[model samples]
Target: MNKKIRFSDINMMNDYQEERWGYRVFELAVTNILNDELLQKKFPSLNEAFFQKVDEIIAPLQLLLYPVISCFSKDPDVLSQWRAYADDGRGFALGFNGVALNSMPVTLLEVEYDQKIQIEEMKTALLAAHIRNLESGNDFGSQFRTDCQLIGAWKVGFKNSAFREEKEVRSLHMLDVCVDGDRPRLVDAGGEALGKEVNGEQVGYRVQDGAIIAYVDIPIPHLDNAPLIQEVWVGPKNINGIGNIVYFMSECGLKDYAIHQSKASYR
Candidate 1:
């Protein structure tokens, strides 16, 4: 099907939100990494610069791999995962994640947050960025205008109801243990640890406030989850650009997408 993948608007988005809406958890992390100070002035706070980087990555991929979340609750605990996800006062133009995008329902049913979300059982890392060296960009969360910045997944449990407001909110756990990345460190997780692997033999991590951060010697991984916006998902008008992106990505030897698929077998 030739579908139009779009960054939605207020009116149309309200419709999606009322139904089922989703956001790419990695998108926020990629945005922060793109604006890294180490990259010098390559990334500016300006919309053009930011989006250009975003489009560069998206222009090349197969959109089918990109997933989003829909039917999210307005509960404060849920919103705390990425506080800046909404509220302009936070920082950056995050309208895309909020009102703009829609999730692929087929993919979403597999990772439903309410299906007994916990630390060990959660093997998939929604988003992970490495903090190589002390100055590594783990602080990207702080730069992005969010109070809660941690390397963890949103542990969710919910109760459904006919009435939206009457629905029960059970839990949202931003679970993470801080380690010292200054030495050899291994966060014993099968797939939930999405960030790039460290190269140093001795490093450590520590959880301060509510975030998990580390300092290491390896080249920190920028963002972990598979990105949204692929050529397969794009409209016909942009096929040519997407084609070129695919070609370039192949020629440049970009890393192939190797994300963990959900094991949930639903009826």
Candidate 2:
């Protein structure tokens, strides 16, 4: 007989609490890097260094749908949906150290100043912190990488045609995470066999602590119609570690309407 599982039986709070410890440390590092008085004084209005660092760290993960922004709809439903996506097991938290940085504020700030000096400074600082943390044996990013390798791979994109049209018209963006050296491969949620394709050339990356880091920008236009992404299977070769690979996928929606409203009010 199969036993029933209840939400009470699951320790969701404990899970989040445990993850928050590492997230807090990372956050502190990011804050220090971005808010450095010297850095700010040099850049004047925006922090370009900080934004650069953020991009370096996140760019590899291929999760962000758009550049960081601030303006966001106050709609509770929208916020709730975002929260659910972030909390979902197949969300960004599982990988990248369980630190889910909301794109709303970042995107707003970026567009406000066209990702000026301040944003670049912030990105640089964040990337520095991430590298430092990794080299210093923090293991947060490393752990997340390991988790991602185990979970395999998955894909994410929009569903409704209207959403896709709006996004394309407004230049909607998405990211893809490819592991296991450089060979291009695709798999479904059920671990079923799909197809493979060879890209131009494979760039070599160092595998540290059984984790490899690489970056690529693959535009997935097909995903615009189907936004529902549950899980993914990373290729076998990408699964470097002994245990399972943790897969995480996320899509960022640019609130063009919100930005338009903000501009209109200011005008």
- Please provide, for model 1 over 46-87, each residue's C-alpha lDDT reduced to its tens digit, 9 standing for 90 to 100: 234434433343333222111112333333222222232333
Report the alpha-carbon TM-score of model 2 versus the true structure.
Answer: 0.20
Q: Which tens-of-lDDT digit does each residue in 1-267 have in candidate 2?
A: 111111110112212332233233334445665577885666443355434444354434423121111112222122222333334222221111001112111111111112233334434544555455456565546643443322111111111222221121111121222444875532111111113332322222344456553322221222223322222222212323312222212123311111101111110
> After aligning candidate 1 to the native by TM-score, how far in Å is the CA of 66 from where it should be?
24
| lDDT per model vs. reference | 0.28, 0.28
Taking all chains together, each candidate's TM-score versus the true structure is: 0.19, 0.20
List residue ranges in candidate 1 displaced over 4 A: 1-109, 113-154, 157-232, 236-243, 254-267
Error (Å) of candidate 2 at residue 5 is 38
- Model 1 vs truth, CA RMSD: 22.8
Q: Number of clashes in every candidate structure? A: 28, 52
